[model samples]
Structures are given as structure tokens and as C-alpha cells.
Target: MNYLTVLGLSAATLTTISFLPQMVKTWQTKSAKDVSYIMLITFILGVSLWLLYGILRQDIAIVLANAITLVFNLTILWLKIKYGKTRPRKYL
Candidate 1:
């Protein structure tokens, strides 16, 4: 493979690895109250667009990186919804 492709793969690997800790932490801690809904949603949207762009451009690096990142972010979003929810208080 060419150096550029290697570079791209290296970049993709690092970015993907970087996001893994958050996924693991969220899963282990089961606490996502601190995670922002807007940020996660916005980031996911942006990543989705980037994935589409990569597909159009036929760039494997961008496609793979963003696709994995999107899944990670979506998992976090799901964890946030599942763990961050609180039962409403009842008043007698």
C-alpha cells in the first residue's frame, strides 16, 4: 500500500481507538448524565455526513473511521438514554 493510504489507516486507527475508552466507560459506569444530548446528536450527525462523503469520495479510511465512530457515538447515546433517565417524583 502507498504511504498516503498507510497514513490514512494510521489516522483512522488512532481516532477509532481514542473513542473506545468512552464507549467502554459508559458501558461500565452506566452513568451518562454528564453526557450532553445535543453534542452527541450533533457529533453523530456530522459523522454520518462524513461517512457519506467518504462513500462518495471512495475513501476507505474516512468511511471506516466515521462508520466506527458513528456506532460508538450511537452506543453512547443509547447508554445516556438508558442510564441518564430519572424517575419523576411524586407528591402526595
Candidate 2:
């Protein structure tokens, strides 16, 4: 692979993996009040667009990263909808 491809993959990996911590935290705490609904929704939309763009261009790294990001973003969105109204724990 070329240097640019390697760089793209590395960036994709980092950005995609960054969502994992937030996902796990929301999952474990069962609280998403701190997570902004608007932000999550906007992010999901952006990521979905990126996925479509990747599909159009047949870019593997973009497709893979956005696909995974969509999943995480959707999960967070769901959690926000489900638990956004409740008061979350102070410590978590």
C-alpha cells in the first residue's frame, strides 16, 4: 500500500475507535443525559453522508470507517433518546 493509503487507514482507525469509549460508557452507565441529542443526530447525518460518498467513490477506508462510525453514532443516538430525560449519575 502507498503512504497515503496507510495514512488514511491510520486516521480511519483512530477516529472509528475513538467512539468506542463513549459507546461503552453510555452502555455501562445506562445514561446518556450528558450526550447531546442534536450533536449525535448531526454526527450521524454527517457520517451517513460520508458513507454514501465513500460508496460512490468506492473508497474502502472511508466506507469502513463511516460504516462503523454510523453504528456507534446510532447506538449513542438511541441511548440518548432512551435515557436523555433521566438524571444520570454524578460519578459516571
- What lDDT does the true structure give each of the candidates? 0.89, 0.89
TM-score of 2: 0.88
Residue 63, model 2, lDDT? 94
Question: Residue 69 in candidate 1 has what lDDT?
Answer: 91
Q: Lowest lDDT 10-mer window, candidate 1?
A: 83-92
Name the top TM-score candidate: 1
Clashing pairs in 2: none
Task: State how far residue 38 of model 2 sits from its true place (Å).
Answer: 0.6
Count of clashes, each model: 0, 0
On lDDT, the candidate that comes out on top is 2
Give stretches of model 2 more than 4 Å off: 85-92
